[model samples]
Target: CEQVTIIIIIINPGFVLVHFDISPASTDDPDIKQMMAGSTLRKVKSHSWKKHRHFRLLEDGLTIWYKSRWAGRGHSTFSVSDLETVRDGHQSELLLSLSEEFPSDQCFTLVFHGRRGTLDLVADTPEEAKCWVDGLRKLIHKSQTMDCKERLDQWVRDWFTKADKNKDGQMTFKEAKTLLKMMNVEMNEENALHLFTVCNLSLCVLEQHTSASLMSPLLSRDEVWKVFQDFSADGERLLVDELENFLQIEQGEREGRAQELIELYEPSEAARQQMCMSLEGFQLYLCSPHGSIFNPDHEQLHQDMKLPLSHYFISSSHNTYLTGDQLRGQSSTEAYIQALKRGCRCVELDCWDGPDGEPIVYHGHTLTSKILFRDVISTLKEYAFKTSVFPVILSLENHCGLEQQTVMAQHLKKILGEILQTSLINGQVPEQLPSPQDLRGKMLLKGKKLGGLEQRSDETITDEVSDDEDGEMERESVEDLTKDTADSNKQSKLSRELSDLVLYCKSVPFHGFEPARASGKCYEMSSFSESKVKKLTKDGKGSEMVQYNVKQLTRVYPSGMRTDSSNYNPQEMWANGCQLVALNFQTAGLEMDLNDGLFRQNGGCGFVLKPEFMRKTDSEFSPERPESRPGYRPLRLSIQVLSGQQFPKVNQKEGSIVDPLVRVELYGVPKDQSRDETSYINNNGFNPAWNETLNFVVHVPDLALVRFVVEDYDKASRNDFIGQFTLPFTSLQPGYRHVHLLSKDGTPIPHASVFVNVSISELT
Candidate 1:
């Protein structure tokens, strides 16, 4: 015998209100809100392929979904948060290629953050294109301005939307269990039910009837509620007093700031009037920028910029023309634009004579494609101060003859115009190199000069000059030229007009530290190969090198043997207080990651002030032995890996989950360089918890960079990289925090983070 039974569960109305309180992003622009209806545009992959695709902004206003008409069910989506900016008209290569066929007004480009490829789109009319461009810009601004809590709420809402397969706005126990698994939790049925029941009991009343209905089950929301209850005297709501206690005790916030937070985060008018916060309001407060892991005080221009140029480490790039290997690669102005956009204040240009008396920039004697020097100059003039207003150093390896060099000088003076620093700043030779603030919006050429600063502009003196000091030679041709110049003192004719433009950064031969200091010529700088610098540092000259860099500048570049455009670790050069440690900026790896991390502070102005000890001309600080330095204090850093959220899968195969592990690395002085990793969490990439602690003793916290790396654990072979984030140790905010992870190309991974507890204390 079988008896038919039906169970009905009713959810509390309060719970429903709280669950749906996650509102869509609001905008004053009606055109942006109308984007939810979508439009059909031509997606341009190249000049040949332009497919009609329907594009729509989701109701959340954060994501955009697009699909071709032929693809009935297949679609692609990207979040507005992933975009860097939007370019109207033919700003991209693909769009420019289509300019002959399509009007510039009908074209636009979507530039994504990091290394993500740009999306070129063509609208039916200029009005349609403007609609999309303006709407997307407004949405991107909203995404950027969202508070931390709102971002987390959006993140949770996105997960709920994905978990709700039937779109019923309610989740059953079965669906809840599936959601847990999808979130990378391997919990038993009993535990899952217990958690679900506890969350329901706290928020609503469940009644038995014919049908069962419950509010969506989000584990993060439950956790927030639990945290809220801990601070609430009566688990129903948090009063002003309770909220203040939580802020001061847990978040290290100052006293009397709770009321400000309540007014800012509380969504309900009644709650605001009563000075009380509901669960939703409490959750919002917890996700706000005040609760973020990164210290908000450091997000703006906080560092001093009045110091001399040699007192800071400048962000620089080598072979800025080549986007690939040194031998065979495409040299385009786009490479310069990308580097400049990334805050590279120093860019290298290898000039060779081209047809029609024009000079071209490329790797000399190599098969790399060439870009006209005039075009490059135009690009530099346009983008030099886009990302940063600091002075730009154009490191020119001039291999062109007199006529072509004169043409190069003409283009520089014509295109760059007033931005070019032709002579001294105050009509007097500077005792020290001018500060970045003093040289703001100025471009300085770094190349060979004909005569001394006091010499007349028309005076030209030929000298044996080898621009290969940084090992710019790639093939036998450059090597033979360098050999001939060295062996027979062969002299290359200098263009007097071009030579007059060289002022601050005159490339001079380096003999020894004693002679350089004796000359006291702060304007004269030298470039050394990475190998040469490494040898000098290792040969017991590290302290001397540090002192020498206090007034003069030193630029270190990669060895010529790196034909593949690989980069040496810039930290090694920076450790000696070398200002311009140029690296292959196109390569995405640990080297570039470290470079980006160091320059990510002080509003990413491309110059970071060196440590005090390294800046003092009379002080002695060596990277090899940091303990002996004055005011040396070793500190203990403890990081507790609590859990991960929405880790992107490294393997794209269906149903493939990752066993993720974390590695915490400390890069600085030799004594402080160490790494510690946590054990892998098997078969889970989302919401995996390790609860493991990694410790390090940092001897030079000011100079140290802490990197957090997440990788997919494979026991049979090498672990695959997932994502990583690196920041200076001084920038770390100690408390329970979330480390937002970045992709290999240094772009933020949407909704991906590792929650941890960080503590720093003086070593006993």
Candidate 2:
């Protein structure tokens, strides 16, 4: 007799008294959730909760209260508790009715947790409601007690008996995915592999063990659960190792899959074009109409560090420098010459469309007819021809769409290509285009469909920006696809570029109010665009590209942090042509300290440093890399940092901590190192710990050296060392990527304070 059991999970709390603002997130049945939570639910934006009502957020489940008497005896506790009573018409009264159905001094609280902040309700009126809650809690706990293995075993035997109709042992990916969906985990290719590999890859290992293994082929149903029980530590679905195991194919198969996957990736050149045309990735917020084709006022900057621009500035809504004079003005040719004279490598040239549809130089969005492209080319040819390379980038302002902008970009690319080709024939941009794809290949379409955000968009309701912290998040997902194969060579190359740009790369500095994306409501829940629509849903977290046996970081990246649409990877974007991605430190509670890539043990700049690459076979990046895998090997780098940043934020939505003293964290730093040019300063030598206090001396160098640290890993001293870092030294090197940290170990405590003194010149 198949016992199809279902747990009776019903709401029994009678007198629900919520102190905070309560309302219906639902339109159809606005009163349902509040009614179910309690009989009397009070709500508003912020609640002035009263005495006698208490609230507490639990780690395991929800906590709520039911009020039997508004004037009952009880004192308020902390900031998260109830203090004043709130009445919001019928919702509160109706919600309080639930507590009316119960028997009166054994108080309990109900905490309703959503994706963001939680809601707390109190009921001190009746003791009956508390008793009911206690009973219901126990029931809920017992329902989840059945082990997955026991459950798996039952299903296996049943499936063997049923699918066997005659009982067959083998289950295909299709069958497995379906079975998993019924169990609540919707499986995709990577997810499926992750689950099977992470949970139980031994099934295919040389020592592959399963009940079927014991039987030497045809397996019985119950045996499946037995194997699950053996490997699962806490009986949780799958541990990280288990996930790794699921993808843990045999030596031969792993290599073959890597090769096949490599071919499926979008090319690097395609990615760069996608980024340029990727209207959303790099959005320009113009507070005022700019440039009418004015000559760029070229200024000189110190070129000791490899920052190519001797002196360049971008005019935006937000001023990059407090001192307006940090960046000077000059004509395009003069700016190009001055930059070249100062050993500069890159400069920004503003482009505008003229009335004739010809693109011309001037920092303006549009000119009388449209900027004429020929004028700018003539200017460059007459003056810049002699220089080996002009560290110049054409920044085109558009008042139109892809259909119109593409032509302008094409003209500019043509001009630059001709100019650079001449310089290279004489000596410029490294005779060979760094990555052929970046320079010669065509850009691919990042098939974007403009539509309303899907239902499960990341919620910003409770994730408000805080003044106390930078509010950034650490690493979201890590995909362990690095098993040795021939593609590793290519992947390594791309990863390095991506790593450098993300970690070491420096973005152009603007000397005006660059209207923040936040002000324009551009971002939805930290990532998705409110104006930009999601047409095709993908589930690889936030990733936009990926492929095997290729050396690009974008192809291997996991997914978006906030979206639920699966199967999207961004690794290929880096491998392709994209250069920059707009990221915010506030989202993760990290200040600008951990913003750069290479981490130091001097400041509380908790971030991922550059990752070391591995080649399963004998791997050394010599003159060139071998295209085929010499061996199939996997490598691991368990970095142990002595020190780094403190207060690298966590999701307050998760309610882990506002700014815990010693929280272990990790982040994803870029693989490239070309952008690392910064000064390093020595500060207090102490690291962060749970209780130990470390003193810091304040000092701001030109560039910064940053790092990330996780506490309580191994020894007693470990906690204090997590996220410790040093300030940048004045003697900075070119192409060095270090981050300037806040005043934790440095003198001034906050990052803004340190940054306020430095101009656009210091940061860029």
Candidate 3:
């Protein structure tokens, strides 16, 4: 058979189409090429906020177009790059409720975390859902590559906008060279001419052309179409076989999975039979929420969760009774609720005598208000195991008289019934503490023991004299605020009922590491004041401290200087293998951010497995003994602060902007390193491009948190925090990425982010 064929292409503001004919004479025709590069459409129903609508994926960098009834005019469009996540809707509790209400078989959701909130959709079957998820994962994984390709084009457009110095859409060769220099690119006559040619810019006539005659190097709409066509490949498209290869699927399951993905991503039967994926299809898949950091079926989720309790870094809270300062703050049960809800596995209670003879919890030697001890125990009973089933530690500082102490014990036994660890499990005295799995849904009490001395005449006389002078003060104050005096070494008596509950965590004085170990009381866990630990570490005894923490537990609390409940650098203590580095959970700052980042890993179960060297029974690794660990690699981290978006207002002035500077800190042991921009942008927080790079050499990456803090500069006082984001060094993905900033209360601030380029290498 003989035939003639012709091809045509159409371009408009809202859409682009390719039309071509094929015959025997031209079997390898333009239609095949068009099929490979052009956009493809599919009929699908989308629901955003309960409104079902029809949308299409356009070829312009994977934009989603809302079709309008009128031709050449569309409702609106959103780009795939704007999307943050796409995943199975069943994973969400809200959607799970919807599933119960509507009972759909196949459901998925797209999370455009920046502007567009979410797009929820339901398919006919689960098979379709799986295809959509897998295809979206593959496409989103390619977003980095796509960004790299488009970056240069974006730079060209931005340069044209900036270099049009007079805002007349034109620039001379000298002006172009100046822009190149600003971009840190070299330029010569040959390179300049080549750039002009590639960008479709014509050279100005030297004799007759004015500066206005020399036009911009920006591509016009038609020129943009031409560039797209030139870059588009003929017959270059993704096939099922290619996707299977990209997925690295095993041969046995390849055929079935590929068929499912093809159906999910390319819905049209014609496109499926053709065994090709159009550009538009690839973009749509990547833009969807198909990839996630957390997977329900991850192998780590099924592993044995049994280990010595001291072998994990438990998330703990300091001053859990107070919502504010230790001096004069309101003590409320809400503090306990908030701490428990945020995954705090341990809470502190400073028990003192109340007016009614009932024991109460409050900070001692301060005006802080008090709450009933029974109320705290009741709150713990209700919320201790709500967020997690892990064990909870009740760090009790008892300052009550024997009568009130007995009453406190009765309240705990009655309220915590069957859930309190009042005795050792299995009726055997463990040489070490039990595993978290062994104590799940149980609470353990920790407090000092009272002396059983028959005669207390000498000390009683001195105590009576002191009490007479201050009768308004409580009989005993929380010993945490009291320094260890000579009499502090004396063991005081404890009620048998309360003492039995202190089976594992016995609060004891930390005189020295050798004495603590030689005492042969492995069950005794000492709480060290932050200053004491710092002094010990500075005195070159950090190695001994790390070794002591292996078979026993050691807690480090904030120093007394932090009277306002602010936190210190937690990573400093964590690096020394301290088991319980308690922070003021109510305070929000860089210290808390670092603490949050370190605990964010290990599934946020409030238990992170200690590093092998730190957990070893007979190991020698320490902050001072770096030479003992041969495998410790020093990391060289280089971060480029590119720009920021959606910056919040710093002042109340109507049109006020922020004077923003980025502070990058490496929080770890040995020392914390910090470097901030010497100067800041005057009044532009949104899109303040510094293109500045900061570098750091880290000695302990495992215990380190890389903190990116954005602050509004203040010349007269400490800089005000705007927003910040934190993550462990190990979890960071190197290259250009966006860090979503979080507010003071740890809630994500939408549409707020810092664009950065990170490069990590081993420091020789």
Candidate 4:
């Protein structure tokens, strides 16, 4: 059976039909090309759970199919684009655990994007592992470099392969109609036949006019022509007037830009001469950066990075070492790498004393696993600036003894070297904190400092203050270093080496707003639990909290009671002008969605400059009274939930189609927060059209975040999440736009999107 299967794969005519020459000839490496031949490898889920599986790369060069012998002919597949990277050798803990059984050179791991689990594999030979690793790297690069149009084309091709159940090159009219329904198009028979006839005629004309060699690839051009015909009145040519209408109505471009676009994107000289666009030109324009839903102007480092760090909302993570719940989670250096890669500027590390005089990081007195503090520091040094060049803040929750603390400090200094910010910039402490631009590529320690910078190095200072001053320790089951009793006031000796490393982000206890205002220490920051911050905000001290945050930085963290490692809504903290509002990065939900949305702007540099009103100390801009704030203006936001395309199946059971619905949510000032959803479209996940208009009156557009959520409607149970996309209202581009949907973990879902028309106008 195995020999027959190999022969079939080698000589199959269907392989040629499925293969697309998307990768350039120059990039066709021998190793990658060899991946078309299948191999057998051991898939390792754990030390005791390893089984042989047949693995093969498809002819498309973008997908991998794998199946176990026990599964018979059934197989599972994943796209190369889904992978974040390929790690050679025993880089992952799972691969490293099998070191005794498998040589390091024979193992590799495929790390996927978002929250997907890593795939660990052990090949029969070292050369086989290298072939897989190097081939995957080249394929990943090709996937990442594809433009918008290329990705869409690949997505369409993938769907076609799935629809071709017979594995034949041709599809009957009945098969084409079924494919349309599976793609979420609910057209009547008459209209569907008419459209299918038009497409068939378009392909026939292309095959007749072009050479035999070009006929095989004409299907892609036919798809583009179909889209062109939808917008063009003549169905053969797109004039400048029609192009202008598309730009204005579909692309949300202002009037009179059609001629410029034609000059810029038109590939044919005839189309350029006529001041119009062809089918190819239209596809090029759609693939351009300007055609994206995100404003292209904000795609780079467009924001002012010279502002003080406190004047910006920083992306942050709490319990950065944990991959799961705080109590029993596994702590690994990979957590730090993941956080930094996602542009988390501030990461919390709970350091406790470990064996061999090394400090370990984990939730203290819990079942959670521990990782060496030095390893976390080394990981940070490598990945801190990989995604963003902005400075990173190590929010250390130090509970280590003096001996291990010194070791921790030594490891940080030695491993990080020049990356650590051990002294004031320019050898002077300024009245205001330095900007992210000034501290680029630097890492600051956010923990207790022994004393003032003038204090003698030999002097011993008692670190008596607790950053978690709200008695969070008493709420959780985990034991705290300082229990809630007379012993709660007990102090630990500070290590001079560690204390000196805390320069810019010296951790201090918050007494009151008056004391913070009087001290005026821009470098001294405080950490407050979510409960305490909520109390302060609700007690009419919201204005003072904002004013205090404008000078001295304030960090808000979740309550210790949330042992599940859940997150508080960071927006509430942001509303109060909090700088470092940390949340559990390991958790995925609405809070994390909001966090990703807010930081998805300003080039995702981990810092977004606060609005002018939030930064001004005397502006009296309380989130509780947004209407009375300076420069306050109410805006009417209208969004027409038009349609969705290629929505993935929420339930993968056979013939299980989703009843999809679209929900538009507004998150901001309390009164401005609301949600409106369209009625569900029955048995249609592919191309559901709502065309329902939802209007919102945003009182604070600068702080408001608009979230579009699609769910599979269920009458008997809660709706299951399908996909969503969220962005700040300020970043939203008006006019007709396609909102590319993301999985729950915030990774892009290929070709899954919602088309909507947006308009925002000031409300009188």
Candidate 5:
């Protein structure tokens, strides 16, 4: 028999109660009295105005109150739906004043911001502070993951309250226009009337839908009344009590859990006493800046500093000087600035000799524009560690003469100052790459090394052409061609000072694994073209690359054919444990999306610890030889499509609804796979019940990402993307869950979700 555990949580003003059971508990008697006792539950304490208070974090909201018979006995509550941020006292000096009042070592401050003003409170102990912060963060995450219809209901109520300018339950046409402007929605009078008519108030529309009925311009349509009723309990105007119930359902509370929620998510005394939730109030709440999806006080949940540098994949940008394609592209240092700000740990700079004796960065053989190397260095100095304090790798491709190379070195050292890493951190090379934490805020220059000045070509011989007059010019040109070919055989190295800076990350050509290891310079790294590495992986040399990457860094770049700044699927490179998979960051597509998804797991810090098998020195795992594995299991994923809520319109006509279909994509080892819905629902945006089941089998589930994409079907053209949600296969929990839809830019869309029930099984 399989045993399942479920925990039910109740929140009252200033109190949180948790109850666990092996089976579902009856909600008929909510047991508010039992919850109020705070028995068999952990409690977090805070101080408001120097008075002791108890805080409860519920799924939908937060409550703080004093458990007393005195004047401050009543608790205060606010919905997390309108929460904008929860910041620590250290973030704001104003809040720190309260924290300073207690023993500095023992106390911390917390400030919760919602649509309403900030709630400033002090925790008595550091432990209490951490607990409140953690609890509130989890609740905020829970709120973000609520059912789409439920969240949309709260959103509708919130907007309605805001648009009702006169505190009356109805919004006038003038008020509706203002609300539209506030939402940044541009609609002409006709479009506005069309929307209002959809609410079934066309009875009030004139022939051109321009003129409104004279009496107050209030929408008194039955359809509008029905909407209010849907949000209210008694099929009438929403009261505070009814609003509470509406929120509880959206918060995933059980049917009879209303009373417990009422106490927990308390309204203001005036609103409670007034009882009515004016349409104006709903708009006020919905339009207000609720908390951001990101919590300012969220501690680093991923271990950023735990592993050696080689044990992670770094967010990297290729051809950092150019903003566009390799040919005829505009080169600017802004690309470097943008990449650094986007949490890229590695940036490449291709340096060539420029006019006026300055080194410039650009595509060496292309028609791309150029920026001075000094300018690139300045930009790097300003933004290198702004988004993340992790070490930055300056993958320098040197094509400059010795003089300009010296100038490049001077600019780097002068502008970057102490932040530049000129020597090994511990005065010696490490057996393993150092952790990003140990080299924080440091920039390491990676480029070719130059031999001593003795290796310089005889400068006089170039000017002294053959004495034969007629053949002198032609002979010089022929000799120049010969010299160029010979130059390819030797290293076009940097100045001695610059060469010293490339100590750890010296770029070397890759002949083969045995040659690289035998070179006796273990710090020398190689940047492999994507095709070269792919050939190695395909030719059964991936295991060797994996072992090599465990000790040294290897950068894999896009194939030369990708002149449009396109990207190859990076998972194939990552399968070899390649650390630097440099991509054109300016490009936006599925490749960029996958890159973002992978790095997002580790706090978006541009480094994600590799899997244990990849990081191990003695692992026998092989990407090309999966059949040699004895312990591998073939995994099956069964996902049941239940329904969609408030689907966003994609490529349909302005007033036409969507024909929604879902496509599931599995991206990882053993070739990326996908399955799309058999059929799409017609003319529906509210709710489309598919009740369909999709199945997938995978050999490497550990490295997989399951992306659920919703799209609109069109007979005349390609389907339009609605939104998508992606999570690692390992992170997937087998149960009924909501797939929250996100825009292409990764922002969550309100009231958009596909309800799904997932089950995973291992097949023999």
Candidate 6:
């Protein structure tokens, strides 16, 4: 068991390898001294009896090579074993191979951490992290002699060109470079060259394949998924509409339909594209949900339109014939003025006797503590507190009896003073009835006051005399509107009578609008000349409708619907307040024959105050006008009617077709009924045996939000919904704003009448 080893030692830094015989004498040889600093070493070409490497050392550097130099010295092979600094630098990886199979270390990946390096992956699944480093290392080695950018460009051109995807002139460098970068890296010529030379070359050598598939294409490793959360709806999946409503191209709307949307709100093109649609657009979007397939308007478009909660008026419950229940309670003075403050153009007040003989503005004949006549005056006085109010209330009113009538005048004199003489100048719901006796008493008084006793005799005599006088005037002129110059001698006498009656009647002093007081004296009666009487009688068909025996027609028809349009005398009918009348047209709407403005040019104010309504405003009731500096607009009292069909749900079953625009007015007589009932019949002919005083009616569309406004010449007096309602319209159908008709209480026992006639203007 003898072993002999040769060991050699050199005292120099230059590359060398020496050997000396090692037997029992050299058994203590150690490598520590050789590795120690300041150790001396000599260069030699080979070492005997070692591993496959022949170790070499020289001035350039140290290295190891394999050789059979012991038998044949000429056959020595060397491989750079290590290179350390400028001495090595990037040549580090090449020289630092750990084994003779270093070039085949494709399975081992190098990750550089500065001067030191770590072995990341070894022969397992692909180590993306390591590949980045390996690629970079190979890139650095390949470009060892060039500048950073120059080396990259050269490497890219060399590899990225031939690496063309279609073998076309165009190269897929971005894609290839992208993949090279995915391993914690990026693409450049250096990376590209590294990919082409190292990763690409190694795989080819190992797999022994040369085909187009050998190219490894990759994109940069990006942590986009970790950084960004994608909230967009997945394509072709069910996303809740509310959660993510993305509109489609058409969304069922015609191309131009969107233009309409632009007009209402600001809709931009981008918004339109994003399904940020308009209200109409929403309708189009939900058209399927609504199933209103036939709606040519908006309904056919947006399928999902949904309405808010429902609404109705408080007064919808009451259905009366005349809608008279609209006037139940007297408004507070504050309420009245408040109404005026809010732009009520006119107001109505019923005059009843106060404790004294003075007439007071009150609705009921008898007053209770809660309801007093003073309230009306009080409200008016307060109303005057405001200024420059427009369209002040010209009053429209009813008197219960001569007593109430006198009281009405007295109250007007008290509150309005001269305005009452000026404005008829002037002026929700509950249901109740007035006593029959009160009604009867009022009627007896009206009939007597409208008597024909004294005038009957005078009229008869004048009629006889005018026959002869006209014969003379026939040769002269039709000058004195009321005369007849028949015989030369009779003309003088007839002319005198005519002058004494008709001309004077226009100035009849203090016509009785108030309760007939006569200062408790019997009111005087005067006679009129028949020629004069007949001249102003209102039947003259030329320019004005002459008042005639329309009572017969009214009695028979009981409605304004006279089938014969030719016989309809509008001027006379309205002048005399005849209830029965006719219109040539049946249907009404925007197409209705309306002559507007105060006269008949625009849309006309339909009805005029009846003679009875103004009869009390004769010279006797005239008082001194208010002394305020400025004047008021001739008070505008525009009474409008909102039809039943317009009331929310009430017209549903009836299939109501109505204009959204409201039309202002008092209750209108429907176009059909007998003559007798015409005067008092409710528009629909409810309560045909009617007396407007006994039963008045008002029609409100809805109790909710119903606002009944009334003002005086100075614009005063406002009331409210009786108990509850938040709407502009409320219906207590068949009840009047009773103050406009009967006394404070509705009983017509002591009846009164207000005659109103309407004539639509037709330009000849």
* C-alpha TM-score for every candidate: 0.85, 0.22, 0.61, 0.87, 0.60, 0.20
Please give, for residues 1-764, the per-residue lDDT of candidate 5 as tens digits: 11112121223222222121121112122332222222211222333434545554321132232343353645555555445446554333234434455533433334332112245555656655555555555556656665422343345444444555665445556666555544324456766554544434222322211122221123222322333467876653466557656555432334653344333332344544555654434422322221111111221436647677888889988887776787778886656766775679999887889999998888766678888898788778877877788889998866677899789888988999999987676776565666888788898877665431123332212121221111001111122333454444343433766776665575655667776555435455777777768777776777888888887788877765676878888878887889999888877667776776676555668877787777777766677765555567768888887677667666433345677888888887654356657478876655677878898887777677777888888999999888877766765655445676777755567757776667778865
lDDT of 3 at 324: 85
Count clashes in each candidate, considering only residues at least 3 apart in sequence or on different chains: 4, 190, 9, 1, 12, 154
- Which stretches in model 3 have alpha-carbon errors above 4 Å? 1-304, 449-492, 671-684, 688-692, 713-719
Give a tens-digit lDDT track for model 3, residues 1-764.
11212111222222212111222211243432232232222222322344434454332223455543444554566545556556675533335446654344476667553223355665545655555554444445444454321333333333444455665434555566555544323356666555544423222222111111122332122322332233335534566666555333211222445556556566345777887555434433322222111121331333345978888888888889877877788787768876786678889988888888899888876788878899889889987887778899998867677778789999999999999987668877677779999998899887653321111222211122122112112122344356454444333445666665677787665667777667646667777766767888876677787888888887777765677888887777877788888888888777778767766665566777777788787767778656558687778988877666556766644445577888887776664455555357776564566778888887777766787788888889988788887777766655445666778766565445676657778888
Report the lDDT of model 4 for residue 658. 86
The number of the candidate with the highest TM-score is 4
Ranking by TM-score: 4, 1, 3, 5, 2, 6
Best by lDDT: 1
Native-referenced Cα lDDT, model 2 = 0.24
1-764 in candidate 4: lDDT tens per residue? 00000000111211212222222222356776567777899999987899999998876677899998889779999989889999998877777667888999999999999977789999999999999999899889989997654565555556555666776544555555566666655556665555444323222322111222221332233434655787799886689999888777656678998999888778679879988788767856654656556676776788889988899999999989999998889898888878888889999888899998888988887889988898788778878998999999999887788999899989999999999998888888678899999999999998888676544456878756443562112222245432565555567778989989998788777788898888758888888888888888895668888899898788888877788999988888998899999989989999999999999999988999999988886859888788887678999999987777779887665457888999999999786789999999998787677889999999989999999999999999999999999899998888656788999899988778787778888997
| Residue 259 in candidate 5, Cα distance off native in Å | 15
> Model 6: per-residue lDDT, tens digit, 1-764?
11222111222222112221212211132221121111111122112211332322211111122333354755342212111111111122222333252222323333221112222222212332233233334333533443322322332333332234353333233444432332213245764554444332211221111121223232111111111112224421212241132222212323344334332232234544553343322322222212111122321112111110000000000000011121233223333433333223233343334555554443232121222444455445555325212123222222233454454435445655443322110110101111111121111010112212223234322222232122111111112222333432341212222122211011111122132232211212112222232243323221111112111111001111211211221222222222212221211111111100111101111211222221221212101111111221111122212111101111222222111111122221121101111221121210111222211222211101112211111113232111111111111211111111111111111111111111111122
User: Counting only residues 3 or more apart in sequence or on different chains, how many pairs clash (N, Cα, C under 3 Å) in candidate 3?
Assistant: 9
Cα lDDT of all candidates, in order?
Answer: 0.79, 0.24, 0.61, 0.78, 0.60, 0.23
Q: In model 4, which residue pairs have backbone atoms overlapping below 3 Å?
A: 184-687
Off by over 4 Å in 2: 1-392, 398-595, 598-634, 637-660, 663-764
TM-score for predicted model 4 compared with the true structure: 0.87
Tens-digit per-residue lDDT, 708-756, candidate 2: 2322233333332223332222222211012223333222111110100
Model 5 stretches with alpha carbons more than 4 Å out: 1-299, 450-491, 517-522, 627-634, 645-648, 671-678, 745-751
Model 5 scores a TM of 0.60
- Cα RMSD for candidate 2? 29.7
